[model samples]
Target: MVLTRSASRAAKCIFKWLPNEILHLVATELAPTDLAVLCRASRLLKNIASPLLYYSVELSTSSSLISFARSICQSVDASLPNSARLLEVAKFTDKKPPISPRIVKEINDALCRLIRLEVLILLQRSIDYTYLLEHGQFPQLVVFQYLVPSHALPALTSFLNRHKNITDLGFISPDSLKFSTPLSLPNLQSFMGSFAFLSTLDLTDVSLTHLTLLLYPPDIAVSHAVLVNLHEMKMLSTVEVMGMHANERAILHVIAGHLPHVQELVFHHFTSTSSPISPNESVNIAASLETLGELRSIDFGGVGGNVIEDRHMVAQWSAACKSLTSVILDERQWDFKENDWVVSWNL
Candidate 1:
């Protein structure tokens, strides 16, 4: 209480002397709680503090999410004073007496008013809030991610078409392989989602630079459509793949074949049966790396049973790919230093 009062008094004392630009800068540095208190100090302060208070919001529980929704709904005409640009909800938990329809409507209404939102991440799988997306059109929204409902692909497709400004997107759900529509995002630059999801999109015209694929057993068999898209991405430079069911060597080969110009490669969470790659396999992998003339860094941090720290293996890769500068294996980093591989423990 004392600290809050002191902050309020300090803000009031400075408001009279400081310029509005200075006040805006100060408000940006204040925590959300302090910003809320500043809003109550005076009308001038409220105007300055309200925007920062709502600029970036992160809700982690049902109660807080409901309160935030209600607060926005109760604002002037349930619209003004909204300047939220980034909103990330951890999840909507399942407790007895679930969220009511009234609450949902309020959330939907409040979301519609946040026209300036740029990044929206709904990390909840329990509630399919995908419907709320249908009610709002965020003109500045560029990045959107949510747990998609298996039946909401049409709605998702429609949303993407309306928001052509979106460049980065991700949505994981059961039966994602059902998506067959030829979706297009001319502005898309980076995407992170299931491999099955990537195969369904028509992105041959898009110049993607970063790609992250979530793999499963079924995704091991790379589709022709996926290969076509990969081949078409002339600007792609970074790639990250995570899965346990696929062969690491085969995955590397495919990447080398289509993305010979890739600069950074990461193979995460792959549980390989071969622990320390056999001499023959190491030779073969190095031989494949030779094709990627632009490859600068390769990481296999969480690949189970894979020993990427072997100096001999690192040396082979460095020899095969002269551009290789950094290698990460099992939390250890090896950098090509002065004609030798230098080891750095990341763990």
Candidate 2:
């Protein structure tokens, strides 16, 4: 005779109870309604759900982000060095006043309590970044994505100084950046160079492996010069020029003379010199693209339909970048049609 335990008695068993780990996995996979029900199971369920939710919270608008941040620095439980992760931060932007100075210091103090914070991504939201060096002074930041206000140079420089282990640093979009003091991150790997004013800063000393400049076109000429200035730091991988006139002749010396080491490249505008830049130099077509020998790809940009004179230019690009396997061109012009250029890949 097989006897079965009573329902209440079986429910009381710890092993029989749905494990919080399993619930967590399910919570992530289940519908929001299902997840809410699990959270209501008990305090234990609530605690687990909080981390899964708040640990990587991506908030919405900058104003909303400010409210939570305000509450974080104000919470009676918000003591520095022992405070826990606050949940539900959004990824938005607003000109909310920088966190008050007093709150800034406390938030910094609170972050110090965290023995570890592996990855932190602060998008467009304005922050009390002044306190970052104090708390997010974390030892090992693998990916640090923060868009700093250009005026927050002190805060930015400070963080770079304190957090020496950041592998990927995204300065996002720093407007009117006057200068960059020396950054001492010995282990730094990649950097997103988007600030317009950064061209004046001397970044010659830092070891940068992969660098990108998504800044405006007028500045691209200056930025390209900066890349050429890198001399012989060979670990560089890709170069992208956005919405820029392709022929920035000033770069010929640096690109050809100095940076022969760059392998993959991208282009948007090819400036026509009206006269061949170099007598034998030919119009600066990839067909004539004698420089950047190791280039493998080019990310072409959108062109207005009014311009119909880019056939020879496109053919030159195809012929010049011999190693190019991928060419991403915009669809509006169909200049490729007249040029008899079929890239096999479309927009």
Candidate 3:
């Protein structure tokens, strides 16, 4: 009982400054052995303890996330923070292949049960609920974590659909991670993830204001709808786009049309199979954006010389973008015959 009193005191002290009320728990109840008693040290240190106890009954085979998670469900703490369970579980576990169906279902059920939970990080995990028509909702989800999956797309989609109060969204799944559902995150402002099929993600139509799009050896034709609603949006602040192609030139044309209002633009891993744009090539990139006037900054990466005729096009774009405060280009474009690398802008 002495340990119980100590555990109670520890919980109170740990939460002494926190604005949230600390629900008192018995020391003996929170600790079944000396290791648990020793863990009653500090609040931050307690996260490790909480996930360990909340998810696992036997803390021995913790290297296996599955085993640890199985044990956590048996933890005795009634005050276990439900919102933190996902990350906490992630903290002390290792991933193994040939994913366990039962564990996946259990994690999904736990996530569903946390009606008030607003954050989740289910990396390299499978939480499938094929029969769950409950429409389990998370109206306040602010963050999500999904690594890569062979087929975890449905699990990710279900989580997103249930949450109407989301401000952030993310996913990582198998190649061509495409879904037919229209993503409507009214409050969402930031997102990052990989998609095998860019056609499925209509970001420009969505409310997202900040975005980072990346996937290995990118195929950019997937951005059809997002590229379509280019000029209508006034809230887009930052865009880091990759995998340039003939179609991407169209996307850039639309953005260039609105250049004066943009804060930042970055182009990465751009490779075009077609020959460089000519005077009559008909891809009027800078000409289309004459209305935008200027930009704050522009950065280009991995632009190969073989794909283009002259690097001076960068200078022309900078000249046209009257408000361009900063422009960056790669040093790889320098000629060996002339030590002169070049920039014409005043900035």
Candidate 4:
């Protein structure tokens, strides 16, 4: 599109009058499509917009992913000093052909240049492409979540050891449970995985503050050894358990007995569980609460749903656990108000 002489002059004037910082601020608000247009407008605009364009890349489609990988591999644009701080690559469909071995190599090669990356997430069922990420050298990466295969554990260990900046880590693969190597990351703060996986790691020196234990189907009980290891996490104050089975009471008992210093407790019970938490079970729950003097809040929003309707039981809990400031029973939120419990429904 050719602009008239007057339009071109006005555009030049606008660009000349705007400071680079102001132009950068405007560039940040532009969508990628708009940013691309801005980049083509002028050399100055291109320099201002190109970095923002690649700051965060989330590609879900096969074509887009391949195109992005190719661009990164071919990137000679010095304006983009480093690659994206956040990169999320997800394969949404199973029907599409698997990423070719050559493309996989290209992707891995491209990822190596993303040394400034702070967050990397891979959401795909197959480990074919993800296993290659073990070679990635994202030293600045802080959060990483990927499904790792058992065979790649050795390389993964080396990858993780090299990147000590990672604080929040999650493993979605069941094969991650087989990881029993001695791993250490002093700066690590949050971990999400199964109890078996947690037990396998020697995180005794790592001061983890948040723990999300996935127990869907409750395949393996939270063993005594796991609890013993969990108790050693002195900085651990928040605990979330998502699943249910016959050992619900035992789990609660373990939490109360082991992590007395816990401040917030959340239980998201699976809907697949046949038995709802009974009133008698609630009484047992209250009994467990009585021991948690430092507990500040307990959320059972997804535990028993509407089954826990007794306000009196909550009052009993509030009375027993003086530190309790908030209680979420399913959709209801009972907050400790000015000397009394005020009810608020979470609609």
Report lDDT (CA) for all predictions: 0.75, 0.52, 0.49, 0.73
> How well is each residue in 181-267 modelled by candidate 2, as lDDT tens digits?
545565666766553533543456656567655555456446555665565767766655433344433344444455565665554
lDDT of 2: 0.52
Off by over 4 Å in 1: 1-12, 77-82, 92-97, 244-249, 270-281, 304-309
lDDT of 1 at 13: 73
lDDT of 4 by residue, 8-69 (tens): 43465787665667777887888989988987898777777777888988877777777877
lDDT, model 3, position 74: 58
- Candidate 1 accuracy as lDDT: 0.75
TM for every model, in the order presented, reads: 0.86, 0.67, 0.59, 0.85
Model 3 clash tally? 15
Clashes of 4: 0
Of the candidates shown, which would achieve the greatest TM-score relative to the real structure? 1
Shift of residue 296 alpha carbon in model 4, Å = 1.0
| Per-candidate total of colliding backbone pairs | 0, 18, 15, 0
Winner by TM-score between candidate 4 and candidate 1: 1
Candidate 4 residue runs with Cα over 4 Å from true position: 1-13, 31-33, 78-81, 90-95, 127-131, 216-222, 244-250, 269-275, 303-308
Q: What is the per-residue lDDT of model 1 for residues 1-347, given as tens digits with 9 covering 90 to 100?
A: 00112244445576665667878888889999999899899977887888788889988788878878877878773334347899988765536357777776777677777888899888765545655667678889899887777766777777887888888887666543547687788888888888788876668578789888777667767643475567756689999886655354457877787778799999876453425456787688898899999999998774333344377788888899999999887567888877778776657
Q: Order the candidates by lDDT, highest first.
A: 1, 4, 2, 3
